[model samples]
Target: MGQYPDAYVQYLVHFHGDRDYFECHEVMEEFWKAHPEDPRSATYVGLIQIAVGLYHSRRGNRAGAVKMLVSALAKLQPMDVRTLGLDAEELERRIRNRLADVQAENDGYTDINLPIMDPGLLHRCQTICRDKGLVWEAPSSLENDALIHKHTLRDRADVIEERARQSRLRKEQGEAR
Candidate 1:
């Protein structure tokens, strides 16, 4: 019991890495039974569910794949994967791609093309645009001007004012009196 979490975690890594979905499910079940109240248990359970979904996906079980993957995604919603040794972005990409493939194979399912944009890139662009006093346009299909302004504009009115003041001072110092 003392080493259950660590041991189970190792097993999970091995099972998922090796694509042994059945063993992944069994190993995580052991951990879940022991650490039923553990806050981090959801992460492990979500991983196992994802592995099971991947296994079904690879074996051409579209219904099972969709069911398990959706469940896995829901289970993962409450936890940050960055602190759990899981690459959340990569997992999302994989899940989205897999779901798209499944949707393509099934009827009455809409294909979703999720944006792959990095949040960090968006933040950097916002900062640069704000500092430059340039208008920023967030990529959106709607043509509403106010919506565009609301989403893209950074609240940097104070910084812009300060920079203008500094520039005025520099200009005044350079002027001949």
Candidate 2:
């Protein structure tokens, strides 16, 4: 739908279809960066936190999961999220339940489906899922180790190089000053 950004729709697709929470975080973070002044900035951060929380939770990082989900809940407001076509109350309730589960030291991971209130948005996500050969609202594939442990497993050479370059630039600027 034209109502949503491509990155947001991509985020929803990865989030529910493949259950790739890491990818969800990536897409939403890009959107947030590109539109820092957008009114939905806070909501975007909350959404990214949700994905990161779920990723940590599924990886059995209870402390990390609890921290991210709590931050997400704190940052998100029902009215603010409603503007993004999500069921704000249900989303809050789900995050709270997930936080409770993480705090209680639940040993298993469960897939969470964001309560998307817009039919058009849902259809758009489903279409994208089909195109990508993924199932909509699929259960977590626990056997997929790459998806489960993406943060630790994925290559970060590019990220490392970028950080180094930024640091070098800052040093150069300071020297000039």
Candidate 3:
């Protein structure tokens, strides 16, 4: 089996363990940003979209869920992701199933596990989950407001500040022109 990165392991842990899809996107996105030239760039994006889609689905955002999941399915196609220790076929199948559910406006959230093809990778992720005091394959806690509505509930001061800074810089550049 190929070597998996620490961030990917953490992504799996948060994904299957705590059902924190937001964290799944975070860890994988950070890794993707750091390793932009990695061979798995498209795969990373597809995985991130999967997480975001699930998050939106759980939050009852049907339109958002459909958008992300559809994009994810497209990005994942025409690429072999088995090198990343994931069952590419199964992953695609699951994404399709999820997309269908979302398209039908089911309004039900289900935990989607990334099919880890490598035993070593699965073991490593499970070990990390155990160390972090999380149960593997736990279902999403529907009643957890913070988890369900993380995007709106979490602090975004830094994001807002950065956006303002960018706007100011753009305005200054326009004035110079």
Candidate 4:
């Protein structure tokens, strides 16, 4: 049970980040079945549903997307897992954003856009620069440079930690103002 949950969580992160929505659903289903009563289980399930909705949306299945996303939002709306392992607030924010996208599509809006970024590219750039002892002054400029090598797991973790620290500092400074 524990292994399945952990594996599911890993798969969730992997597939969600990679935009493999269907795989995300398949992975999370394993955990959802084992712990239907757990609040976190609902959170994972809701996320998978959201991903599936997104997949449907990309395929131009507007009705299917709306149905799936609405159900997913309903499932997520009652949960209070802000202090849990998952970022509940962010998940809700994403759901709301997706719902808006679906609404726009359904309403015949032609400019509907989704915010999707390539994590692998970002990681690769950061790792390559760090490995070469290159310092990046501007975060945005990192994308302009060519990636020379792939990032090791430890290097990737360090980059993530550094970015988190910088984000916290910015947040604290903003709060103090």
User: TM-score for each prediction?
Assistant: 0.51, 0.95, 0.92, 0.50
Q: Which candidate is the best by lDDT?
A: 2
Kindly give the stretch of ten consecutive residues in candidate 3 with the minimal lDDT sum: 75-84
- TM-score for candidate 3: 0.92
The number of residue pairs in model 4 that clash at the backbone is 0
lDDT of 2: 0.91
Candidate 2 segments exceeding 4 Å error: none
TM-score (C-alpha) between model 4 and the true structure: 0.50
lDDT of each: 0.57, 0.91, 0.88, 0.54
lDDT of 4 by residue, 1-177 (tens): 012245444443443333445556667777678777875676666666776776566556788788888888777644333323334556666667767877786543221212223344334434544565544222212122121111111146766899999999999999999
Task: Give lDDT tens digits, candidate 3, residues 129-152.
Answer: 899899999899999988888877
lDDT value for model 3 = 0.88
As for lDDT, the candidate ahead, 1 or 4, is 1
lDDT (10s digit) by residue, model 1, range 1-177: 112345444443334233345555667778777888887677777767776675566555688878988887877743345544445777777776777778577543222222214454334444554565543442222243332233235476887899999999999989945
Predicted candidate 3, C-alpha RMSD: 1.7
lDDT of 2 at 14: 92
lDDT of 4: 0.54
| Root-mean-square deviation of every model | 21.1, 1.4, 1.7, 19.3
